[model samples]
Target: MATKEFKLPDVGEGVAEGELVNWLVSPGDTVTEDQPVAEVETDKALVEVPSPYDGTVKELLAEEGEMVPVGDVIITFEVGEEAPEGGSEEAEAGTEAEAEAESESEAAPAEESAESAESAESAESAAPAPGSGRVFAPPSARRLARELGVDIGAVQGSGQSGRITEADVREHAESGGGEASESAGPKDVEVGTRPSATTKRGEESASAAAGGAEEGGAAPSGVEAAGRDRTLAAPATRRVAEEEGVDVDDVPTDELREGEAFVDEAQVRQYADAVKRAKAAEAEAATEAEPSGAEPSAAESGAESGAAAESGAEPETIPYRGVRRTIGEQMQQSKYTAPHVTHHDTATIDDLVETRTELKERAAERDVKLTYLPFVLKAVVAALKEHRHLNSELREDDDEIVLKSEYNVGIAVATDAGLMVPVVDDVDQKGLLEIAAEVNDLASRARDRSLSREEMQGGTFTVTNFGAVGGEYATPIINYPETAILGLGAIEKRPAVKEVDDGGFMDDDGPSEQVVPAHTLPLSLSIDHRVVDGADAARFTNRVIELLENPQLLLLE
Candidate 1:
């Protein structure tokens, strides 16, 4: 047959080896070209290897549970009628070795037949002369008969063709007189006295009879000749019985093996008792071995008390790896690289709330929901337009600030793992509904860890909604490579005065009717002082709050 050797192929970049997970074909099985012959598991993913030739499998060169290098021969196949001639010197040597093995096997049976004939002829010539009354028996039986001082021909044979077997010779010796009956002895004997030869033989007969009775009757009844009862169990049940300190052979396996190898209620109780005893011993040993002066440390005691106060608390630790690791490194680089200054302020949002409520009702008809985030984002975009310095970037090589006209805002979304900021490109060109939808999509993708690297990079400014999680105010760190980030806090309802057309003073006291409205969300701006001064940050925060409070100004922008 034409044999083809299949070599392992490179699966992926820099992967030198792969684990052979399973083999699909065995020796003598036929396989077609491009058919999956094996599955390999690499570090990243599982892959399949296909046959290179259509042929019957000749040999498997690599065994399962073995590591093979790439390009090694994994399998060989017999392809056609004619075997290929040796193409290399190594192939010729392998052929010679196969020929030598075949010759050895063919010679072994002939030599065994010759040896058997020689042994039979030697045995016939070695036989004793006639009248010696010797019997034909195996060498082992003859040796045994000599040791017992018994004549072979006198003993009855129970082997093939009436030949004397070892067992038959033993039986004849044990009977003490063969076919010739001897005289009996007295039935009674004194204590500690040695019995006569005849008495011993009679006693042996009685013992054999008793043993036969016990084997036929008592054993099947689960009772021994000594009146002790035992149970029957399977191998697995026997193992459990040993561990549980139960006598497996004495226990009835009927209940334990009823369609399944399961222990009954009594066995379960017995196991529990053994386990309890073992636990009690362990506890006692531990109590004895404990040092008298051993005590909890102050920190440990405090932590224990704290844990008791919060009974159901579960502590978690997350490794800063992958995206989170990148975030940590970037944040650290920003904090040390850029000198940051934070400015915070709160504005009256009564007008903004009223305007948003009016816009929301209209937005519903357009299949959109106006939220505070969009209003803040719109305000931040407008502020960027007004103060170009806030939207500026610093050049490290030239040590000069480069201000850009286009505004691209990135919103930071906090997730269970860490922070991710996805940018909204060209925010100035989008309308309110478009901005809202884009912001929603970005934030949702950021939270779900589906944002691409491009979506996360290239931004002029960033806004973080700390207020969503109950924080009143926070000076968010600047997402460096950019100038600033805005932090929004929770809004609360407070009493404030409004300009009345009638020119009357409105107080909290019932005299004029003060307007109790939801105030504007507090905003904190942290900017790179190297690029923009405190005045520039304050102006940017004021402009953002103004747009948030009077959201109608966003449409004008």
Candidate 2:
């Protein structure tokens, strides 16, 4: 086989290098052309790199979390072909012969293993009994079996093609067939042996209740005693239970796979939810059982306060990595490099709000979701056409300003992972409904981390709605080469002065009009002072305000 190296391609605009976030393929795995092999995160976005050759992965040159430069060999593939070099033809022939001999020698053990697996499968098919033979399971299933200290060969295969599955391994462990030391249950718990001074009586009551149901006797109130086997749960599930102050042993499980108890994170969450509901129901029942306007005794209130005080608080620290680190670095760079000047203003969006309310039902009938963002985007694009500097970039190296003719506006989406800006292309050409649908789809995909590299790039400008999170105004950083960014604050209702018209019928002798409530929107525009003047920023914001106040003007475009 001939070996070939695959280089990392540039994923972002002018991006020289990228961080290798994950590898989808491992060595010895066969890959097809155009198959996603690795996920690379550049300064601009996260993207998947596809395999260019149809071959088996021989080596991964870059490890996960490592930054690899463009044009570097990230992976090696072995194609099914003879060596290209003829420098040592005889030596190559000798090497091939030696490899064949080694393969023949290895084939005997492989054949023996296959035969043993077949015998085990036949025994299992005839009767569900433990067999002494080799196991046939996927790598993941085998790893999980080892972690549980179960004998995979003795477990019955319940998967297609007679292969052992993870469920089978879990079942074997639950059946008490695995090493006793590896199995965990409530009986073996050693934690919380020394009762804390602040430990609540409710826990003891719950444990006593559990003991009575299981052992036919009440457990001690103060300290717990080691009784039965420990609860079988994954490490992660146990951690979650501990964090929530729930005893893992008391968590009941009806999820039986092949008669083996399976307790997963979902089961734990459901149990917690059930407990909360039960407590709420008991409280309500007690409240209804009490006399009208009855107050709790001072002693009862003091005990509740004491219990609350006993619950300790700990600070949590999350490591900065992945998307969070990238966001921080970019923000720092933008703040330091650009001289940002922010202009704050307010726009009365009562007309735009009413128009949206009117068209909402019609949009819904056509399976389209109409949102205020579409109107905002339409208004912003119209304003950008008149004030071109906001949509342009400052080329510091060339000492010039580059105004973009095409309108590609990026909408900032805050996700659990980090902040992701998914660009909406040609906003100037698309109608309001089209822009709304596209924004919704893009934002949805961004939160799910399914947005492609191309979907996030090529933005001429950016618009961030800090208002979504209840913020009134923020000086949003320019999306690095872009000249300016528009921050939308929370749309709120406030008192406004009502004008009495002289030409109207009620103006001459009727009661004077007073201040009334009106819907208002806050706008904060941050511009690169080097590229755009203060007047330009003010003019652009005013135009956006005009379009939003009178949305009918958007139809003129």
> How much lDDT does each candidate structure score?
0.56, 0.65
Candidate RMSDs in Å, in order, are 34.1, 17.2
lDDT top scorer: 2
TM-score quality measure for candidate 2: 0.53
Per TM-score, the best of the predicted structures is 2
lDDT of 1: 0.56
Supply candidate 1's per-residue lDDT for 65: 37
Q: What would the per-residue lDDT of candidate 2 be over residues 426-481, giving only the tens digit for each residue?
A: 99999989998898877755654546567778999999888765678788999988
Which 10-residue window of candidate 1 scores lowest in summed lDDT? 105-114
In terms of TM-score, how similar is model 1 to the real structure? 0.45
As a whole number from 0 to 100, the lDDT of residue 308 in candidate 2 is: 48
lDDT of the structure predicted as candidate 2: 0.65
